[model samples]
Target: MTKERVLRFGRAQHLIGVAGLPAAPAPTGSVGIIVLNAGMVYRVGPFRLHVEITRRLNACGYPTLRFDLSTLGDSGASNESQSRAQQIRADVADAMSLLASHAGCTRFVLLGLCSGAQNAHIVAVDEPRVAGAIFLDGYAYRTLGFHLRHYLPRLHSAALWHRFISRKLQAAANQRGDDVFAVSFPPRDQVRRELTDMLDRGLRLHFIYSGGVTRYFNHPRQFRECFGRLASRPEISACQFEGTDHTYALQVDRQRLLQEVEGWLQRNFPTSDGSTA
Candidate 1:
């Protein structure tokens, strides 16, 4: 059995979230899992993915919290002036503190998708309490292989040529405003350095990509290509679901992702008694 409750936390109690707790005590070494908002979406995640993930982890004896960022969803805006990135990191830290006080969780694992994944990476790299992170459609850089795989197949399609010409024409027009929901990728070298630092500190990292970002990441091996020798680290694992959309819209795709997450947790953070808590 599992239990859940509403939580309001953060500096001014401006954050809102749901916490899923196991019926029995969590495993001796289980880490609390924090699920962040996907883009501008609420804590429920796209198609209630966050809710599903929280329940599944709860069943395995892990406490999970799914919450909105400072200005997104039900959370109130922050009064302090800070960059969006700073606000995100502060919000994540506040979440960890909340879980620590509420569930006695000293360690954490972050789970996110798309923009949420980027936030997870930012927080996990700097926060010492983060034991692991699961990133879906996270930071990806174009490689020689990516260019070949992306353009070669489309060369024969007349539609591609038409679209290319259309894009060129559109490029001459005035630029649009920045999209608040769109993710801004940091430098690849910076990300690679942070990833190396996290791995050196024994953090477990999982990178999963869907077909939605096929333009940037197509195959599983592309992870290796993007990060170079760092991809060879034993602490890192990755998967590519070729047909799955960015949000795992299909039921079957969602199920597959859930199963993968469960398996990774079991393999990396099993209970002391050799059973799921």
Candidate 2:
């Protein structure tokens, strides 16, 4: 059986969270898991994905916590003057501390989607207590293969051609300066170095991308292409659900995502009896 409790705690500011506790005993060295907020969405996650994931992980004998980071969900805002990055890092640390104090869990796995994925990566780098991290639709950089794969299929579509021409004509009429879409992706080399360092520290990393970020990512190999040799590291795993949207809007997509993450967790952090951790 899985039990859930809603609670609040913080160091600088209070944050709301739900703790998912498993009736079954967790394995020795079992680490707790924490799910972070995705963008402005509450701790429940897009379509309550976090809630579902936490329940499932709890059933698998891993206690889980899903929480809002000050001002996102039911939490109050922080009065601190820290930068956004600093605030998120501190908030994650607090969550870890709370889980440790309450659950006797010193190690943790952090999970996030989109902007939350960015925060998870940052925290995994700074916090040694983070044993693993699952990044959903996280940092992505385009590569030559991505460009080819992106444009090749569209080239055969008359609608795409018409839309392309229409967009160009609109751009010409507006006399707009260099048409650059404002998208942010982390620096490739910097992320590679960070991943290398984390892997060296024995951090298990899992990356999942969806079709929703096609503007930046399209194929599975794009991640490997962006990070070069680091992608081949045994500790690193990547998956692309090209048919699914960013939030796994469809129920089937959501289930597939849950299965993928559960399997990854089992493989990377399995219990002594060979069950999911």
Which candidate number maximizes lDDT?
1
Best candidate per TM-score, number?
Answer: 1
Per residue, candidate 2 scores C-alpha lDDT tens digits across 1-277 of 8778888888855888988877765555788899998888899998999988998888888888999997888998778998888888888888988777666677899999987888899898879899999999888888999899878978799998887689679868977554222236678889888989999999999999987788788888888889988899899989899878888889999999999988888888887778756
Give each model's whole-structure lDDT. 0.87, 0.85
User: What local lDDT score does residue 206 receive in model 2, on the 0 to 100 scale?
Assistant: 95
What's the TM-score of each model vs. the native?
Answer: 0.90, 0.90
The TM-score obtained by model 1 is 0.90
Runs in model 1 deviating more than 4 A are 157-181
- Clash pairs, candidate 1, are none
